[model samples]
Target: MHGKLTPGLDFLSDGGEMGALMRAHDWSTSPLGLPERWPQSLRTVVSLMLTSKFPMFIAWGPELAFLYNDGYRPIFGAKHPHALGLPFRQVWSEIWADIEPLVKKALAGEATYHEDLHLVMERNGYPEDTWYTFSYSPVRDETGGIAGMFCACTETTQEVRSRAALKEEQDRLRELFKQAPSFMAMLSGRDHVFELVNDAYLQLVGHRRDIIGKPVREALPEVEGQGFFELLDRVYATGEPFTGSSVRVGLQRKPGSPVEERVVDLVYQPVTDREGNVRGIFAEGYDVTERVQAEKSLRESEARFRNLADHAPVMVWVTEPDAICTYLSRSWYEFTGQTPETGLGFGWLGAVHPDDRAWSAEVFRDANAKREPFRLEYRLRRADGTYRWAIDAAAPRFGSDGSFLGFVGSVLDIGDRKEVEERLRESEAAFRTVTNATPALVWVSSNDGNIVYLNERWYEFTGQRMDEAVGSGWTAAIHPDDLGRILPYWQRCRETGEIYEGEARYRRHDGEYCWHAFRAVPQTGSDGTIERWFGICVDINERKRWEEHQRLLINELNHRVKNTLAIVQAMAAQSLRQVGDGSRPELQAFQDRLFALARAHDVLTRENWEGAELREIIHEVVEPYLRQSTRHFEIEGPRLRLIPRTALAIAMAIHELATNAAKYGALSVPSGCVVIAWTLVPDATPRLVLRWQEQNGPPVAPPTRRGFGTRLIERSLAQDLGGEVRLTYDLAGVVCVMDVPLSDEGGMLEHQSSH
Candidate 1:
C-alpha cells in the first residue's frame, strides 16, 4: 500500500505537494484502488485543482472517493492522511445533509453556486461555525457521462461576522433612541437634512413620519418664520449650541388644519466628528404649552372676584375689592338656607345674628380696607333658625400684578368648641375654689417646670405675697438645705412623668421650719405628653414627732423585757439548782428557747419594730445550725417581710423543728438534709404555705408523748398566725407544713407581706 513513489501514478506528477502525496498514498484498500485506476476526467480535474492556490476538492466514482489539493489541506485539519481516498460522505459527515443535495445536483450534471453559505463543521477535533462561498461543477468520465463532482470554495466567515456585529450595534442604538422620552432629531450638512428622528420627535411634530431624509426647511414648512430655522442655521454654521426656554412657535401640524401656537423649551447642539469639525445639528426639546396656558387661566380668573371654593369642608365666601359679596360655596348655601340670589352681595349680611351684625360689619369693613387677615367669633343664624357660634376668618388675595382682589373667607362651626370652652372655664374656676378651701398648700406647674399657680394656703403658710408665692419665687421659703435635693428630683420626675414624693422642710409664717410631705402628679394630654404638674404640700411635723416618741417607748420596753427574761432565767436556774441536778438539762433547754425568742425580737427591733423579713427570722434561729461542717439545711422562698408577732411565732416553730431534727431526724446523719420551701397561695384571703421536708434521715414513728415544745408549735403558733399547722411522722423522714394567713391586699404589697 505504501511503496516508493509509484511509477504508475504518472497523472499525479507535477501537480504540487498533493500530487506527491497521492503518488505515495496506499491504493490496495481504497475503493478507487489507485491514481492509475482513476478516470481521465477525474485525473485532469485533480491535477488542475492541485496546481491551483484556491481551495478545491474532488469526489469521484460510485464511492465518491474524497480527494483534495494542497491548497485545501488546511481545511481537512485532523482528517488528513486517512482522508485522501475516503468516501466523501464519511469525510464530511457533520455537514453532509447540507451539501448532499448540491453533491447530487452536480453528479446529475447540473452546476451550482452558493455565496456566504452558513455551516457548522466538525474539523480539528471540534465543531466550528463557518461561512463559505463555493461552486460545485459536474465532471465527466471517459464515457462522457457525469460521474463525479468538483468544488472550489473560499471562507467568508470574517466578512460576514463583521457585517453582523455592525448591524447588531446599530439596531441596539436605534431602539434606545426610539424609546427616549424627549423629542430628538438629527439634521445633517449645511442644509440641515433630516437624517434620523425618534418616536418622541414624531409625536412632538404631529406624528409626521415622512420627514426623515428630507431637509428641515422642506419637512416643517410651517416653522418658516418661527425662528427655529434661524436657530438651526446659526448652530450649524457657528458650531455653537442654542438653548431657548418657553419659545413661541406656530405650526400647521395637520393637513387642512389651522396653525396652532405652541411653547417649547428647546436646545440645538452641534454634532461633530473626531476632527472636531461640525457635521450636523441635534435638536432636543419639550413642549410646555399646557403649563403656560394653565398659569394664564389662573391669573385671569382670580384678578377680581374668583370662585375660590365650591366643595370646601366649611362655608366659604368671596368679596370684591369694594367689600361686596361675590360668591359663596355650596356649604354656605346648605348651612344658611340661601342661594345665589340671597347670598350674593350684601345679602349675606342678613345671615349674621342681629346682635352681632353691626360689629361684624364694622370688623369686615376695616379689615378689607387695610388688606389684613382677621378671625372673629360671632353667632350666625342657621337654616333651622338656631343661632350657632362660628369662627369667621379671611385673608386678602392679590393678583399676579399685586393688585388686591378681595377677601376669601371661611366660616367653621364652633358651637361644639364654644360649649367645651364654657365647661373648661367652669372647671378651672372650681379647681381654684377647691384649692383655696383645702387645708394644705397646692401649686400648679407647667411642663417646663415653672410653677404657674398657687393657692392662698401657700401664701398663708409661707407669708409671701401672691407674686412671691407663685412661680419659681416660692422656692425662697423652702428650707435652704432641701432645695438642692428637691430641684433635681423634681427635674427627673418632670422628665420621666413619674409621680414625685418627698419630705422637705419649709419655713412657716411664724419663722419655724416644719417638715412637709410634698407630692406631685403629672397631668398628661391625650397624646401621652405631660402638660402640667399638680402638687400639694401637707404638714407632717406632728406625725414625725409622734413616730419618734413611739420608737423611744418601744426601745425602753424592749430593754425592760430583756432584763426581765434574764431575771427569770436566773431564778429558774437557781430554783433547779436547789431542787437538785435532775432538772439541769431541762434548765439548759429552757435557756436555749429563751435565746431563740431574743433573736426574733432582735430582728424586729432592727426595722424599728415595724416588721421583720421572713428570711431574716429563719436565718437568726438557724444561725447555730449554719456553722456546721456540712450543709444539712436548704431553705428557699420568695422574699417576704412579716409583722413582728408573725415573725416571733414563725421563728419559734422553726427553732423547735431544728432542735428535734438535730437530736433524732435529718441532721442526725451526715447524708441527711432538711429542705424547707415556702410559697404564697393567692385566694380570697391569701395564705403562706411553708413546707419542711427532711430527706435521707433515720426511720421515724409517732412520738410516745407530746412535749411542751410540740404543743407550742401546733397550737400557739397556728393561733398566732390564724392558720393551720400539721406535723407528719413518716417511715422515711419528718414533714411539717404550716399554712398561715397573709394580708388581703396582696397586690399592693411587694415582696414584703403583712402576715
Candidate 2:
C-alpha cells in the first residue's frame, strides 16, 4: 500500500522505509543464512558497539563500506555519502596510503597481522597523526575463494607513545652503567654466572672483551682460590645479600705469578622473582687498597709507641693541651705510688711538693698556652713522705690539621744529684771564709793560671777591687821584675798540680814593691783532677835579713873554739915532755893521757857534736896505737841520733884507753888489733853500750897508779853523760865497756851537778 506522509514525518518515514527494506531483504534471504530481520535493537546494538570506549572499525576489502564507529566518524565527519562504498584510499587518502599495503597483502591470502603504524589523516579538515594496530583477514565465499578483506582493529597511539618513553628510560640506564666508575655486573642462574657486565667491570678484571654468559669462576679465574667463588656460592645457596668492608681479593694476570691483590669494599645484592625466590645476584664494589694499608700502618705505629711507653724506665705521660693527663705509663705508678686511674687528670698535681707546686703550675700553664716544649724542675712527694727533685720535660703533640692535640712528657728523679750540688756550694763558701780569715794572702786560680777566687787578704795586699783582680787582672799587680819568673812558676803549678813556693816581689797598693814568700798547692778532686789552686803569701824580708846575720856569727864561734883546743893540746904535750926527766914514767903517762882527751874533743867538735859513727870514732882514737890497717870492727844497732854531749864524752873516754894501749899494753906491736862495737838495748829507758877489746898484744896486768888515762876514761863519759864507764885490764886484752843513757844524757848530768 502507498502511504501519505507529512513533511517532518516524511523525513523519519524515509529512514524507516530504508530500515524496513533492509529487514525485508534479510527475511527473504533467511534460507540463505542471511540475517532474518534488521531489528531496531540490532541497529542500535551495532551502533553502540562501533562507538565503544576503544577505537573500533569495520572494513571490507580495500573499501570502508560503513563507518558507524566513533573512531572512524572523525575521518569522514563532513563527507558522508561520498565516503560510503568508496575505496579507503579515496575517502582518507593520507591514512589509506599506508593502510592500502596491509589491505592488499591480506586480500592476497596473507595471514592477519598488526604493527605500530603512524598515519597522518585529515580529521574535520585538520591533519592529525594517529597510531594504530589494525589487523585484516580474508572474507571467504562458501566455495572458499577470496571474496573481500575483513578487518577488526583498534587505534594504539597512547600505547605506542608510552612504549617509546619506556625505551628512552632503558637507554638512559644503559648509558649510566657504561660510564660508571665502579665495577658492576648482573649475575643470574643457580651458578651465579654473569648475565651482563659493564665496561668498568671488564676493565677491573683486566679482560679485553665481554664476559657475558660465562660462569663467574671461568671469567674471573684469578679469583678461584681467593674464596670469592666460594662466597658467591654461599650467597646463591642461601639466597642472601652480603656487604663487606675492605675485603681482600687476589687477581693474577699470569698463571703461577704473584697476584695483583687489592682491598675492596663490596656489596652483593640478590635479585628475586615476584615470589621472592632469589634468581640472580648483582655485585658492586670499589678498590680501597691504599686506604686500607694506610689505616693498618697507623694502627701498627700506635701499637709500637704503646709498647715503648709501657716498658720505659722514666715516667712517660700524655696529657691534653689543657694540661689534663690522659695516660700515664706503668712507671708512673711505680715511681709515684699511685695507680693509673688516680694519677690521671689533675690528680697528679696533688702529689707535687707545696713549695714547688705554684711555680710548676705557672710554667705548665704558660707552656700549654704557647704550645711550646716545657722543661722545669720541681719536687714531687714520694711514698716515704719526702719530696724528691724531679726534672719534667714535655713536648706538644699536634694533629694532622696542625691543631694542638696534647703533650707527651717524661719525669726523671734527680734528688741525689741536686743534694750533692748544694753541698758543694756550701763547702765552697766555707772555704772562702776560712781563706779570708787567714793572716796570709790567699788566692785560687783557674786551670789556665787565671785568678778565679781570692781571699780578702789578697785585695788588701794588692789594693785592687775584687772585680779588678779577678781572672788575669792580678797580673797587673805583680812586680814587673818578678813577673817573668812568677808567671812561669804559676803555670807549672797549674799544669802539674805540684806544690809551689817561690820568693818574688809584688806591687803593693802604693805601687811599691815588697818581698813576699808565695806558696801555692793545687786542690784536687777525688779523681786526681786539679780543680783550682790554694795559695798563701807572707812578707819574708825581715826573716831573710836575720838569717844572713846568723851565718857570720856561726863562722866566728867555730874558729875561736878550734884555736882554744889547739893551745890546750900544746900545753899537755909540754907537760908530758917535762915529766919524762928519767924517773916517773907514770907521771909522763898522765900528761900523755891529758893530751889524748883534748885531741878526742877536737874530733867530736868537728862533727857538730851531734853524734859520730861508732866505727869512725873508734878508728880515730885507735889509729895511733894499733897501726894495723886491717883491724876488723863490727857495729850493730838501731839507727840512732845521739845528743852532742854524750858523743864528745864518749870520744874522750875512748881516747884515754887507746893511749894506754899504745904506750905499754896490747897495741905495742904491729901484730896487735883492737875491735870496738856498740849496740842499743830497746827498753822504756834505752841505753847505748860499747865494748872495746884488744887481741894479739902482750899480757895485761892491773896498773897500780891512778893514771890520767884511767881517770879521764871513767870520769868524763859517766859523770857528764849520765852513763857508766868501766876499764878492764884482762889477760886476753884490755876491755873497755861504756853504757850511755839514751834519754837524759846531758840533763841527768846537769841535775847531778846541781845537786
Candidate 3:
C-alpha cells in the first residue's frame, strides 16, 4: 500500500496529510530536483523524519529547501503547504537573523541545539511572539559529509504564559500576607521550617525578624517545650487544622533576657498538594497577652468581693440591668432560709412582706430601667417567719467600658428603729392635743413647704376642714393682696431653712380681712437638719389699728411743730429788726441755728421719726453752700442709717462745722476745697467715723475764745450723740473728726437724748 501511494518516493508514502501533498507536489522546480533524483543519505533522513510521530523538519541542498512531516505541519500554521519547497530562511523570514547563524553552524557539522528558544514568526498572517523547544543538527550525505540540517520542535507558548501568570499571582499573595494586620507565617515541610513571614509575625515573636528559612524549633528555642511544636506536628501528621485561644507561650524577647510570659490565639492549617499529602503549614493569629491578664485580674477581684460579702453583717445582693437578681450574699440566705434556686430573679420578692412586695418590685424595676440609685423601707420575712422592717439601698453599676452592668445593694434590719418611730408618733399626738387647747392657731409644715399639720384652732379660725386647709389649700384664706407677696417670702424662708416672720391679712370665717402675725421656726433633727416648720398664726388686728392711730397723731404733731418753729423765726426777725442794735449779727446767727434745727426736724418727720440716712443729712446741710458753686466741696460716704436723735444731733453738728468753714476755713476761699468723707468702722464696737478736712484754705489759728459753733460741735453734738468730737486748728486748715459708736443692727450704740 505504501509503494502504491508514491512509486519512486517511499519517504513520501503513508505520511498522513503532508505525505499526500508531497506525493502530488511538482518538485522539478526546486533546487534539489525530484524525489527520485535525491541522494540516499538525504532520502534516508527524509524517510526517518516522516516515519517519526514527533515533530521534525529538514533543509536540503545549497538552496536549503524546507521539508516537514505531518507532526510539524501545525507549527507552520497557515504557511504549511507553501513553506514546503521554499528556502529555510524564507520560510521563517521574520526570525531569519536569529536562526541564520545556528543554521550555518549545523551545516558546517557543528550540530547546535536550542531549547525553548524565543522566535518571532509570520507563519500566520501577522507577526506574533512564539516559543519552542527545538534542536538543529546537520544531516550527513552518502560520503558522511554534512548535506543539510534537521530540526525537531514543539510550540511552547501556552506553557510559558501559564508559568508567568502563576508566578505573578504568587507574588501578589506574598505582598498581601506581608502587609496583613495580624501575624502570618508559612512553614515548609514537616520540620516546620519558616519559609515565609510577615512583619506582623516578627512583632509577635519579638526581636526575631531573621526567622525565615529556619525551623520553628531552632529559631525560637524557648518555644520548644511549650506544646506548640507538638501541636504543629499533630496538625501536619493528621492533615488537620489546629486552633488555640489564650495559649501560654514563653518568649525571650531581648538578648540574654529572662524568659517573659505571653499568650496567643492562633490557627495552624496544613498545606497540601493534590495528593492530600501535608507539605507545610500556614499560620495566622494574634498576641492576646494583655487580654488574658485582664481576664485573670477580673476573676481574682470577683473572688475577693464574694469573700467579703459572705462575711458582711448586712444582706448584700446584685442584679442585672434588667432588674433580675443574680447574686445574694450568705447573710441573705441565712436570714431568709432561702436557697439560690428560690432567690434569683424576681423570686427574692417572695421574702418581702405581702403589703410591700408589689411596691418594692415596682420601685426596683423603675430605678433599674432609668439606671438610677434608689432607697426603700419595707418589711422582710425573717427566718423564724416573723416580719422585720429593713432599709434597702442600691446604686447602679457600670462596666469599665461604660456598659450598664447592674446594681449592687445592701439591706439592713431596722425593726428597732421602726418601734422607736412609732413611739415618737404617739408623743407627737400628745403634743398636738396640748397645742389644740391653746388659744393660738398652731400649724406644722414640711421642710418642702407643704402644710403637714393643723390644730383645731386653725381649722376653726379659717372655717376649713383638714383636707381644705392642709398643704396649699389654706392659701385661699389669705387676702389676695398679701397672698402674692407672702407665698414667695414663705417659700424663700423654707429654702434657706430659716425662721420666717411675715404679716399677711387673713380672711376670717365671717368674711372680713384681719391682720395676722405669722411666725415659723424650723424644727431640726438630731443631725441639725430641718425636718419640719413649726409655726403659729396670731390675731393682731386690734394692735394694727392702735399702731395706725398712733402714726396719725405723730403726723399731726410734726405739722404743729413745723408751724411753731416758723412763728418763732418770724418773731426773732421782727424783734431784731425793731431793735436796730449792734446785736443784729448775733441775732441772725441765732436764727440760722434755729433754721438748721428745723430742717433736721423735717427730715426726721419724713422718716416717720425712726431714723434717717447719714447721706441724706450730709446732703441737707450742704444744700445752702452748694447754691452758688457746687464744686467747693467733695462729700463722699456710704449709706449709714442713724437713729432719730442721733440724726438730729449729727445734722446740727454738720451745720455748725460748715458755717465755721464758710467763714474762716477751706470754704472761705474760692479755689479752696473741702473733703467731707465718712466711713463706718466695724470693730468690736462698730463706730461711725466722719472726717472733715479743709485743703487749700487760708492759714487758720485757734480761736481767741470758745464760740457757739465750737461749743455746739464739742458739747451739744458730743453729749447728744454720746460720742467724742475733735476739733483741730492747723496753720494750713481746720480739721474735725466726729467719732461715734454705731450698732451693727443700724440703731443707736447707747442712750440717745432727744435734745
Which candidate has the highest lDDT of all? 1
True-structure lDDT of candidate 3: 0.85
Output the TM-score of candidate 1: 0.55
Candidate models: Cα lDDT each: 0.86, 0.70, 0.85
- The candidate that achieves the highest TM-score relative to the unseen native structure: 1
As for lDDT, the candidate ahead, 2 or 3, is 3
Candidate 1 pairs with clashing backbones: none
In model 2, pairs of residues that clash are none
lDDT of 3 by residue, 1-755 (tens): 33464457776675777777777788888898888888988878888888888999999888899999989988889997889889987888889999999999999988777777888888889988888988899988988888899998888888888888999889888888888877899999878999888888888777544787899998899887788999999999999899888888888887688888888899999999999899999999988787677778978988998999999999999998778899999999999988899998888999999999999999998999999999999999999999999999999988655789899999999999999999999999899889999877888988888898999988888788899888889899999988888888888888888678878888878888888888889988999888899899899999989878877877898888878888897888888878887467777787788888878877877767878878787888877888868338888987777888778778888888888888888888887788889987878878889898888988998999999788888775567656788988988888899898775443453423220
Cα TM-score of candidate 2? 0.40
Q: Is candidate 1 or 2 superior in TM-score? A: 1
1-755: candidate 1 lDDT, tens digit per residue: 23364655666776677887888777888888767877677778887888889999999889999989887888787888678888999999999999999999999999999999999988888999999999999999888998889999988888999989999999988898998877899999989999988887887777744998899888889888777888888887899999999889887777768988888888999999999999999999877787688678877865533344665679988899999988888889899998899989999889999999999999999999999999999998899999999999999988644899999899999999999999999999999999999999999999989889999998888899987766688889988899987889888899999888888889999999998998899999999999999999999999989988988888888888889889988988998998899467789888888889988888877778877788889999988988996647888998887777777888999999988898899988888999989998988877888898899999999999998778889875576567788999988899999888876422113552110
Candidate 1 Cα deviation (angstroms), residue 586: 2.9
**Comparing candidate 1 with candidate 3, which one achieves the higher TM-score?**
1
What's the ranking of the predictions by lDDT, best on top?
1, 3, 2
